[model samples]
Target chain A: MTVQARSLVQITAPRQTGPTLLDRMRRSSLLMAILAPLAILIVWECLTRVGLLDQRFFPAPSSIIVSLFALVESGRVFIDAAWTIGRMLVGFVFGAVPGIVFGIMLGLSPTVRAFLQPVIAALYPVPKIALFPLIMMIFGIGEASKWAIVAIAVFFQVFYSTLAGVVNIDRIYLDVASNFKATRWQLCRTIAIPGALPFIFTGCQLGIGMALVIVVIAENFGTQVGLGYLIWQSWQVFEVRDMFVYLLMVSLLGYGSQMAILRLQRAVIPWKKDDAG
Target chain B: MSSDPSTTLDRTGLSPPAFPKIRVRGLGKRFQVGKAWVEAIKAIDLDVQAGEFICIVGPSGCGKTTLLRILADLEAPTEGEVTIEQSDPSNPLSSMIFQESSILPWMSIRRNVAYGLELRGVPAAEIDKSVDRFLALTGLDRFADAYPHQLSGGMKQRASVARAFANNPEILLMDEPFAALDEQNKALLQEELLRIWSETRKTVIFITHSIDEALVLGDRVIVMSRRPGRLKTEFKIDFPRPRRVYDLKANPEFGRIGREIWTLLREEVVGP
Candidate 1:
């Protein structure tokens, strides 16, 4: 009969009376998230086959599959995909790690937060992509420049969410910890980290998306490898089908990664799932 | 002041078997509420015995829960202290059951019961043994792996009790643990509590506003005065054990004791 268990009892007791409209909507939304994409893909394949849409501008799913197979057989696509994934991993690590550390520092100390507020605020709105020329000038359009672009994008996105997470944890839990004679490090490890997990993971998800965007734009500026390079090169040579093939691959990779992260989240936070029900 | 239980119990033919395990001498508590100094408890003195089921009942604004919190060491008293002979201060020897149970939702039932042991740095082997024993004592063995969300209200409270007892604390502090449950669950829990208390023989200080609840579980009921709480009076029930509310209500002594408590409570509920 812990407090949490008692609360669950009270919460479910009142709501068990009816099949409310809100419950129906929640079930419907879950179904839609699963089914809507498949329906659209089917419609897309049909439209392209019947010549209702121009295949040059919008290649059929079958043609994209052929191009994907051709690229994979030549081994160029695997190397490019690996390079893109590797860059994302490196950039994500560089950006998210420092962003989380600094964010925690800022959240813990209002003085530090205040001191850095104006600097972050000024730079946050200036899109990092707009400074690609300056970055190229500084780093000379190598892997370093691409990684830096991705890192810069990731840092700001993660920093804000981490700060919000730390700042919003309930104060009462902290008070309870202190009363129980928890040491400073113990408090942070038990209370602070668990309290901030939901927010931090959210930031990671957002930052990963931003990192993908930067990788494309950064590779487009100058590079001989990566998914972004493939698309840029294909567009220039009138290989529209090849360009669409790269686009579809990148989309699938991004979507698949997000789904994997969500599954990891469920494993890590089973408590939230039970509570939601 | 008379140690002669014979006068109170001999005529009624039930001996007063319980003895006090903790003492409160001239106890008082004060707090600064905004700009003004507010007195929460005024020179309250009471005695609770080993294995004695005692309940402190008062109105909403009265410091009934506050008194229990002080005993639990969740808060320090501004004025006086409570003395428990067996309480080791070096190692925590008192476990509390809050109004809400307060079990960590993230933990499974077995882990929740093992929490106090973990806090005390008990060896893993011994903690596992003790958790298993108390889980059986509270009849939560079937729910060892279940999350808090999977339990019913009565079952959750049972888990909370198991958690408290698993610590092997000398005393247990319960602050309205069953107040939120429906009448059926509340009654069943009360009966289970009596059984557990008898088996474990741990001192219990229970706080509640329910008069019937106080009469049912308490060996000696201490009625407190409204706000600026003080010990109004105490009553020793001469009823026989294996006592349930239904059985107690049927006894002639139950009606007499119930009437006497109603009179004490009426004074506090009304004026003078």
Candidate 2:
């Protein structure tokens, strides 16, 4: 009977076709997103060229592009971008790994949650950048202090998000796992982590944005070789075009990191594709 | 029907005939709603034979789900006990199919069907073979690679049912598994389930609110009273095996049993 049914299903099932060109274009939202920003840049360029706006504050898009090219030719852009990316990566890894671990621990154990909740709640809202002087005293105003500030900023975001994710896992899924007689380790591996992952991804995305913001602010104090310092240095020297160049780099860095995280989410949670459709 | 209903014995009054598959003795459950403790099931006593299909029909909030949950060992009974005779040590005693399609949304149809066996540390080759067999049985072979969200509600429930059957559990506990489906899908699934049940002969405890559903699918239908659910009545259905759900609806005996069970159920629903 099963064999007969299998053959019947195969014969009756519709053939899957390759996506058409219009379907492919519709699926790629990134192309549409680029248009809006491109339009804004064009309008900004026209306004600056025709003297509708002050050139001192708002440099022409063409002049900013030229300065961007000049920075690239000097190889300073590469150095600054690498430094900024390295600090963000290092800080994010250091903060997020432990944050997720501790968050899971806290989420699963009410006792641990009771002991740690008050402390986390107290420190979570304090702007981490305000603690720069204190961190600088402890780590001595080098890359360590900047790294510390960025890590602290990222830690809270990942921790709270992960905690929320773990706590909010549907009880029915857990009941299903237990009913199947899954061991604790198997439950965690198969059910808990996969169930909590969407929210955890949201946390990581938010952490990345926070990390970029804090790293830039942290660089303002001690660093001489990052995009943040480049922006500040250009401003001190009264070079509007150079400042705009650094600002554009910062924007690109933020955009690039966000896209990277989004790509990771897609690869890991492939089932989410149907949710959009 | 040629079968005799009188041959079936009520567990409350008579001892089970040798080696019952499941035994529930004075089972009860109570939940704390706010400050007060509310009794869900005051007591339930039942003995299920090997390969018997038992359907439980009850009013809403009658703790039918709670009873099923206790049998699945998903919840602890506040009082009494449930014991399952482990006929096979290799297979799990029971696998439950929930009211909602509990197929993990992250897993593809094939993987969802393979989940229970995989969790039991069954080898990959065996899982593949079993998954293939059950998927074909459920007519879901064409959708093996599709995720739960990609499938329709009926297909999702079919995948979940396939998952339970593929595990080859000794007993299947289903809590209103087809209640959310449309009429056509529900009837189609019921027939598919009967075919699967006949082939496997696994002891089944199916919970439902519909008397017609109970009459069509079960070898015996057990009715329960309202809140603090207690076993009120049991009817031995004499419907022959290999019965089609649609055909059963037209049977005069089916309507007779449905009306009898509905009268028992309506009292709990309408009060007094």
**Highest lDDT among the candidates is held by which one?**
2
Instruction: Provide fnat values for all models in the order shown.
Output: 0.12, 0.73
List runs of model 2 lying over 4 Å from the truth.
Answer: A1-54, A273-277, B1-17
Question: In candidate 2, residue A43 scores what lDDT?
Answer: 98
- Backbone clashes for every candidate come to 12, 0
Relative to the true structure, how large is the alpha-carbon lDDT of every model?
0.79, 0.87
- Where model 1 places Cα greater than 4 Å from the true spot, the runs are A1-66, A94-200, A221-223, A234-239, A273-277, B1-43, B47-52, B82-90, B266-272
Q: lDDT (0-100) at residue A226 of candidate 1?
A: 93
Question: How would you class the docking of model 1?
Answer: incorrect
- Highest-scoring model, DockQ: 2
Residue B185 of model 1 has an lDDT of 90
Taking the candidates in order, what DockQ does each have? 0.14, 0.53
**Residue-level lDDT for B13 in candidate 2:** 26
Model 2 clash pairs are: none
> Mind sharing the TM-score for model 1?
0.75
